[model samples]
Target: MTSQVRGGQLARLLGQWHALPGRRRSPDYAALAAAVRGLLADGRLPLGVRLPAERELAEALRISRTTVTAAYRALRESGHLTSRRGAGSWTMLPGGHRVASSGLWTPQDDLDMIDLGIAALAAPPELVPATRAATEDLPRYLGSAGYHPTGIIELREAIARSYAERGLPTSPEQIMVTNGTQHALDLVLRLALAPAGSVLVESPTYPNALAALAARRARIATHGLALDAGWDADLLLASIRQSRPRLAYLIPDFQNPTGHLMPVDLRERVVGAAHAAGTDLVVDESFVDLPLDGTPVPPPTATFDRHSRVITIGGMSKPYWGGLRIGWVRASAPQVQRLAAARIGVDMSSPVLDQLVAVHLLADAATIVAARRTQLAHQRDALLAALAERLPQWRVTVPRGGVTLWAELDGPVSSALARAAEEVGVRLAPGPRFGLDGTLERFLRLPFTLPAADLVDAVHRIAAVRYDLDRAGRPQWREPSVIA
Candidate 1:
């Protein structure tokens, strides 16, 4: 039996539909078709989800039935939807494959598909040696029960020492190990937020963090981050003072997608403002160690916490390797204990082997940081040059750190471009996926974590798809503009 999505549910899921900005030259039906195809391509409309009937959806959306029928017909011709007699159309991938809705890439995924969706890095060269050393030390723990709810003591102390060295003065009792930064954020949100409680986050922040907050059913308040100016401190402070949310999440160092670092003074002010408003601050430092420009990084946001109101989440995922799956949350001793207790229902503890590997890797933190900095600098430069050569119309900033570049297109067609790019074998994370509302459709986050050759080839493939879109007079493409 097929699962049916009702007219109301489908409309709500689609959110506010806007035509591609700057593409008024295209027909409305074609634009609507592209939007629906984007939803399927990004796994937002899961495979086999029966769409609402054309007439029903058109009435719900207040659009003409002819427009809806034309859009549905286009989708069917493009192989993104299938319809049976007396039945509604259903979503499907090209070639009649039913893709899982998780949107995660597995080892079994199509090997030829170039993935720019995930900003994860591969294992650093030091990981193998570290893993071997961890295996040698594993025998001592074989005699004891391996359930370390607060993480193995050695790993906790190592993480705490890392913070202290960075000027945070953390103690082992104040740290709890987690599977990853995402897991750490989930645990903190579970402990700090209640149903219908208010939360504050930066607009265009990490998508997974937003997902975690949504799962808790918390009301979210957003403060916008300007692409060129970095964080709008005055607006953020005002929001905190006015809303007084239960928690505020900020990525102060080398922020995801945007790659802009929050200045030290602004960081202090934000922390102070949150505390004055009686709000707990959750600072995500996952990208803190990946500075590509050799700038001196600022102290962790916890440095300004005079009232123990700041909780910092860190991980080895970006700087070290995604496969390590080791991260930690640093807070007050009492708060750490509460979080560890709350996390028991979710996950008893992170893997001991991974924690041991993290301990070894942390021992040589400086060396690893130096190596990553050098490698990423080269890749970042290569990607910038490639984009300039191929897609000069797209504006991008050279981020001082972080793995991705947030490129702004001249038109609001990121979702459509991503869908089309997939047909040409490149998968991109559309900018709207990173935002709460259906904004940022003009932006695209491209990771520079791949090798220089792969980065170059990916851009070439993307440019080819973009050219095709332009040739078809698709609204997503625009004439190249002179770079100021």
Candidate 2:
């Protein structure tokens, strides 16, 4: 059965479609078709999902019925949309196969591909030593079953002590280990949110978090962030009061995509709002340890948790290494128990050897993170300089921390550009992947985890692709103004 999207919902998804960037005149039907094609190509619009009627969409967008008709006709001609006499129009890929709904431009094991889709770094030099130490410690537990559901004691205590160092007193019993922060988030959503529950999230949040929510079939309400100003506590407070979602997944520490850190004062207010609304604040601190600018990091959000509902999730992926696959949740002891019980149905527990390795790594986290920060800073500077030299019209805020940059493009052609870049062996994560519906077409996420030289080369290739796209008069071209 095809899932149907209503006209109003489609309108919300196609935000400001007619008011396209750099286009002085009203958008023609070609622009509309291109935007829809972009959405399909990027996987924001899933295949087999029924689209709204042309007249209905035209009414919702306040455009002529003829414009919508022409756009649909173009889509059908291109094999992007299919319609039947009795059945309405539905989305489809050109070859009628499923594409990854993650909306990432992925390279299929292409060695030449420069991947900027994921924001993870290579393992630090300390990992080998840590693994060696962990192997020595592993035999001590060989006598018993290696299943440690709530994580091995050593790792749990180390994680708790790390939180204590950050001014939040956490006990080992309050921590529950999982595969990673993503797994931890899934566990929390399963335990905290009921079926069809509502979740409040930032407009451009971590894409995987949105995926998790969608998998759980949760209703999402978003709070938009101003790229220049960052988060507005007042606006968030209003949203909490109005929507009263069951959970608010926040990434305040160098917030994902945007890279905006929440000030201490705003942190307090955000916690208060969630508390007032009785919302479980799932605060993701995965990127907390990567402050490249030496900005004074604020205390953990758990510091302001008046209620026991603030579930603080931390991981070694961003700071240490993604392959570690170790993460933990810091909540009240009872909450930890509940999460652990629920986790048994999934993967019984994380790998015992990995947990042992995590213990060794956490003991030396500060030194490792400091060196990692220096390397990231260098790469980030390289990427920024390259973007400035090649694509200065695309606006990018200088992020103090985090692995990725949220860049506003020169026009609303991010998806089109991403597809074009693939021809030159550069993979991209278009802006719409991080947003709800088909929104954020005017933005893109660029990660700086690659080597400095590689990052610069990737940017150069992307710039060349954009130039070609512009010159070819592709569907992404903005129509110029006309004087009668």
Candidate 3:
């Protein structure tokens, strides 16, 4: 790239973080370095791109040359950048290897059959009007470039306000809107945590989270979160205290598959332990709005996190619609800037139309949440009843919120069991799909994403298949509920 292009890109990048706002005071070295590293993460600065001279950057910003010097030195030490006297600075993506993405999102061979595979709910009704308004307002910003690396202020502010309502006081600068919870989590993993860093995770966490972490080659440490009853605080606290990892990932509120909420005290304890060990915590709160039974639990991990070290990821996919593809992270302003920079390589920015659609959910979240809770509660009850009547041999847990159920079977072969069920036309998530060691072999996950009639049919099919297996001398089993 030409010097002019590089210079302009660098300035725009810095401006995204408000670090280099053109001809003003010099940027903070630490913040500038963070932004620069993010640029490298997204391939904005390719491998071995010659960085601008420290003196030139300083002169452009009209600040002390030492600031740019320190920023370059910081990048070099972090291994994100390197320098030679004649060659100047060179940008490099953090670490060397690019871990291949895990290919795991496949559905069955049906020409549009019942998809019990994806744990997604139908789109909420409230999305209609919220979407209409965002589309109406899009023309107002259409006149400008509309790059929106920082996301629309209205959505950022809305997300932060939502966090504040949950007892985690936040500001717009601390948030970076992404395509979905997966996008936010992926960006945070790329920017804050280095590749191959030890990633502490609950046994059977959301599967996609596992894929995202694996893509970075993060060493996975699985702590078993009991699906039979709920989260094992002892396991979580001990893991955080002893692991001392670079990152501790959790789905505390209505954990995936298992649908267990870590009690408020336990949430605080885990946060405290992570903080004490100086490990960054990534809390996936995608189910924040979907407490199906009883009053929702008050367990916002970020509220206990003072430094925004606990990056809370939430999205519209869980509560609203998967197609909307909106999720965000609640972090400090500096961290938000870092995420925005890191995201560019993977995607220039999340689609504006989707962002606007999400604004619909944010605008009237309460009504949408209430309707979801009621609908999910009904579905949960229906599934439970169906399982009890048909799959009596299998043990199941009733979750308070969210989409899926984790259950243990009479024998130790959920994978084999799932294969058997598939023979009869029902595709179930095998227990081994959740656990890395295949320990949860006696378990199965049932998602309530389908309608009540379909779920009932699925349970009936599962029970009939189980009976056949039992009669044939095969002991059926399942794994723990989560999949990380």
Candidate 4:
């Protein structure tokens, strides 16, 4: 269905639109056109939704109406917009630039379906034994009221000790157990960000993190990441200085989707910059334990923190299993108290049984994670090999660790490929899902969480889908079902 975006709303969504990233001054009409095009490409601006009239937008942005008209005209020429004499102009993607309507993908239940949309692994072999141990240890708390808002002492100590082992000295008073990384992030957002506050994030980051920011209606500032040049400390510092965001969310360890690990020196530089800018950094360490290669992984981002400005989020979902539902936040004791107090209005506490299970799992994490790395290495190799043999035209960066490969297709047909893969019962997430403003259409994320055989099969199915798309000159573009 077609809908209209009011001038005020569009103006807010395009915060600092005149100051394009990496530019020295305000943009002209052509630059304005490119920014709107970026919004349309990254799925932030919906296709087929009517935009505010040129005069209305000009007044809202406090610019001249002629500039808006020229920008609209440029958009029309680029095929990103359509206009009628009486109907007005609406957004649209140019030919061969189709993308998924939604960035979120739900799991499918078909027996034969090969689901790669979610980058998660099955439970490790040690889970059952750990759960049994937890059950045995549950009786000690049977007589209690079963309410520990700050989490039980046992799990908190285990998490804190784990941090200490990684060169960051932490105490149980500084840890607050939570449901998962997403839940922890939500709690941090609630505590750190005011409504409409600015936030800085890496472009092509975790999709759910984007959802969290969107939920709060936060103004997002982005720093782009690429396989060729990983994290640019100077560029990141510039973004921090320019945007002056209230909070910054990053996935430095085997960063989601891209799987590029931040160097130790880079981490220190980034932490120092954020501290200087007074921007609280929320570092996600969910994928820290799944290093498939032998390279030395850097210590947690909080290790470089001298002023307690960094909050580290860690969880068992990625390494052990997603079903555990056990995650924790490491911050200063006072910060932990603040978060725990705020969490009362949310979930009072995590499940006792799950927390108990986590206690046992953390005890043997080293052994279990070693086995997991071996398994993941095999699967990662299998996936790379299959793609090398079948889809050699596509470019893929080899990640030292992490479970996913960021694949770049020869053309901007990621959304079309995902749609076609559904026909063969192979679910895939397009590259735009990991990006902001409907960008990264030429990329796709392929996880190696499945078994070696299943990874091979998925690659075979994807190869077939690409072959069909190539044969047909790409699928016909379909209008998105919903626009918001």
User: Which one is best on lDDT?
Assistant: 2
Q: What lDDT is obtained when candidate 2 is compared to the true structure?
A: 0.86
Runs in model 3 with CA error above 4 Å?
1-112, 470-484
Model 2 alpha-carbon miss at residue 270, Å: 1.4
Q: Write the per-residue lDDT of candidate 3 for residues 1-484, one digit (tens) a residue.
A: 4232255446654554442222134447766775565344322344566777777777766667898888888778766676677867776533433311111112223332344557888887677787788789889778877778768888888888887787777899988888889988899999977878998988887777877887797889988877576677787778878888999888888888788888888878888888899899999998868887575678588888876668888888988899887888888888888888888888877777778777767778888878877888888888999988877777887887888888888887565456556556666666656656335768778888778988888888878877776444321112112323
Cα lDDT of model 2 by residue, 1-484, tens digit: 7789888887776666665433344357877877676666687777689999989999998999999999999888877789998789998765423343335323234558788888989999999999999999989999988888899999999999999998998899999999999999999999999878999999899989998998899999999998877898889989998888999999999999999999999888888888888899999998999998787899998899878969999899999989989998999999999999999888889999999999989889878989999999999999999999999999999999999898999987888788788668788888888888767879999999999999999999999989887655444321222334
Q: Of 2 and 4, which scores higher on lDDT?
A: 2
Give per-model CA RMSD: 6.0, 6.0, 18.7, 8.3
For model 1, the stretches where C-alpha displacement exceeds 4 angstroms are: 1-34, 43-56, 63-109, 473-484
Once fitted onto the true fold, the runs of candidate 2 whose alpha carbons sit more than 4 angstroms away are 1-37, 47-109, 474-484
| Per-model TM-score versus the true fold | 0.86, 0.85, 0.74, 0.80
Tens-digit per-residue lDDT, 1-484, candidate 4: 6889989878876766675532344346776786676565445676689999988999999999999999999889877889997778998776544443233222223558787887889998899999999999999988998888879999999999988898888999999999998999999999889989999999889888998998798999889887766688889888997777899999998888898999989899888888888999999999898887796899888989999899998899999999999888999999999999999999899989999999999999989999989988999999999999999999998988888899989897786577667667777888888877557879999999998898899889989978877555312223333423
- Top-down lDDT ranking: 2, 4, 1, 3
Kindly list the per-residue Cα lDDT of model 1 for residues 228-280, writing each as its tens digit: 87788788899999999999999989898799999889989988898899999
Ranking by TM-score: 1, 2, 4, 3
- TM-score of candidate 1 on Cα atoms, chains taken together: 0.86
